[model samples]
Every structure is written in C-alpha cells, then in structure tokens.
Target: MAGGSFRKSLGYALAGLAYTLRTQPNMRFHFGAALVVVAVALLLGVGVRDLLIILFAIALVVIAEMFNTAVETVVDLYTAKYHPLARVAKDVAAGAVLLAALNSVVVGLLVFYPYLHAFVRFWARSWRGGN
Candidate 1:
C-alpha cells in the first residue's frame, strides 16, 4: 500500500513537470530544443552514456530557464510598475537563461559531433562497398 502511494506521488510530480513544460513558453522552447537533440542523437546512433550526457545538458538549460522565469515573475508581482532596477533585474535573469541555453547548445554539439562524423564515415564506406 505504501509503495503504491509513493508511486502515485511520483506520477503526480512527473505530471506537474510535464504541465510546466507544456504551459511555459520558455520550457516549450527548451523541450523543442531537446527534441532536436534527440533527433540528432538518433541519427548519430548515440550510445547510452552519451544519451545520458545529452539529457543532463538539456535538464540544466530547462532548470535554468524555469528559475529565471520564476525570478522575473516574482519581481514583476512585487514591483508591478516600471522601475530601472526591476528592469535590470529581469534583464539579468533573462541573460542567465540565455547563457544556459547557449551552453547547452555547445555541449550538444560537442557530444554529438564525433558520433555524427563516424556515422557519416560508416555510411560512405558501406555505399562504396556496395558499389
């Protein structure tokens, strides 16, 4: 009974995560970027370990974006009017998200480049062999 309850709680948590990803524009962007990574990984035939690394990178960007959004929301709620300091704070928070997103892109390219090159080479070899 206790185990079942724990599993239900986990499910709810996962559902909440999904809801956030679906509803939040920034999260949706991150999710779309992640889908692109997954497509690249599939094309490159990424191994399990590489896949884990990619997942970690994606998670990092998503978490950073989420935190940035939360900070912006809190600032807006508290200030409710245009203030130079509030604008600076929001911009800084957004910049952090942008940095995280760029970092994730770099990490994805680094991790997948080798596999992509190898896959291309293998395809070329097989095509030549068949001819």
Candidate 2:
C-alpha cells in the first residue's frame, strides 16, 4: 500500500478479482448466472425499474462473495491452524454470502416472473399449434 498510486490501486483490485474468479468456484457460478441474467433482460426488454432492481441484486451477491473471500483470506492469514473464533468468523461470512444469494433469488423471481409466465404461456400455445 505504501507508494501505491491510483493506477496501482485499480490494478490491485483487478488482481483480487482475478484471484477470486480463479480460486472460488461459487464466484465463477455467480458470474455465469449474471451473464444469463443480462441476456434474459435484453431479450425480454424488461422495464428500467425492474432492470435496476435486478442489477442491484446481482451486485449484492457479487459484493457478498468478494467480502466472503476477503474474510476467509484474512482468517487464514491470522491462523493457519484451526481455531473456534476463526471458524465462527468464516461461518458468519459464508452466511452473509448465502443470504445475499437467497435475496438475489427473490429479486429474480419478483422481477422476471411475469416475463417467465408469458414465455410459458407462449410455449403452451405453440405446443397446441396456435399462435
């Protein structure tokens, strides 16, 4: 951090992101889901408000994930050996991630249910050989 310029700060942040994506399987999954969400949003032409909510939910999950990664790394740095306090801290961080993931699920449902329902109905009609 000493002598770290603003450009170096950005580089360090990006490096952390790369490390998380490489080391955390869940982070990769979240990124994949994010891509799908963006694709679906574009295809459905969802309203601006709904899209904003979706984006916020996505960011929430990603933020929680990054925080979890940071917490775990710090805990390990504090002690490589097992300790009850370290376990508790890691568990709490993981819980935060789980809660964020669940929240995102609720957001996705609330924002996309109508569009999903319409797609289902369209499929049903097409299945019956009708427009």
Candidate 3:
C-alpha cells in the first residue's frame, strides 16, 4: 500500500507502541515512573502549568528512550559483528536518553520541592503536637 488509511495507520502505530512496551524493559520502567510522577503531582496539587511541564519532561524522556531503542535495533540489524560506527550510533542514542532522564529529574525536583517541603513541615508539626 502506498499509504494506508488513517485508521490503519493508527493501528500500526499502536502495534509499534505495544511492541515497544512488551520488548523494552526501559520503556516499561519509564511508563511506571511516569505513572508515579503523575500520581504524586496530583496528590501534591501541582498547578496546571507545572503539571504540564512535568508531563512534557516525562514525554521527552520516554521519546528519547524509544528513539534509542530504534537506533539500537537498526544498528543490530545492519551488523552482527562489532563495528565502531554502530557502537557510536548506539552510544549517542543512549546519551540522549540519559540526558532526557536527567532533565525529567530536575523538572520533577523543581516542581515538587515546595509542595514536599510544606507537606513535611505540616507532618512534623503534627508529630510535635503543634497547632
């Protein structure tokens, strides 16, 4: 087919997502982490703009990981034997994932710090029998 129908295209895209979730451990971990982050943000009552920023950060990390997986898969398909160029390609992709993950961590900390601090202070006061 030159170009599939929109529904067919969506199906194919979903299949790829399923395949990635099924086959990639890192993807699963990212998904789990994303769920936790979202839950915590909601619990902390993060503002809409900050929540959106956190979501974007999470998406960036996941997208980077998916791209890294694609690069590794393609490199493996291209050469079974060790090659410097293939190694470089895989390493670069991994670096991108690392950077994205780091960015997400920074965003999470920045977004959640004040909320967490207040939560801790409130709990501490309760423990000390303070009003």
Candidate 2, superposed: residue stretches over 4 Å from native: 1-4, 126-131
lDDT of model number 2: 0.94
Q: Which of 1 and 3 is the better model by TM-score?
A: 3
Return whichever of 1 and 2 wins on lDDT: 2
Q: What digit string (tens of lDDT, one per residue) describes model 2 on residues 1-131?
A: 56678779989999999999999999999999999998998899888999999999999999999999999999999999999999999999999999999999999999999998998899999999996
TM-score of model 2 (CA atoms): 0.89
Please say which candidate is ahead in TM-score: 2 or 3.
Answer: 3
Could you arrange the candidates by lDDT from highest to lowest?
Answer: 2, 3, 1
TM-score of each prediction: 0.77, 0.89, 0.93
Off by over 4 Å in 1: 1-19, 129-131
- Please state the error at residue 20 of candidate 2 in Å: 0.6
Comparing 2 and 3 by lDDT, which wins?
2
Q: Looking at candidate 1, what is the lDDT of residue 23? A: 67
For residues 6-88, what per-residue lDDT tens digits would candidate 3 score against the true structure?
Answer: 77989987887888899999999999999999999999899999999999999999889888988999999999999999999
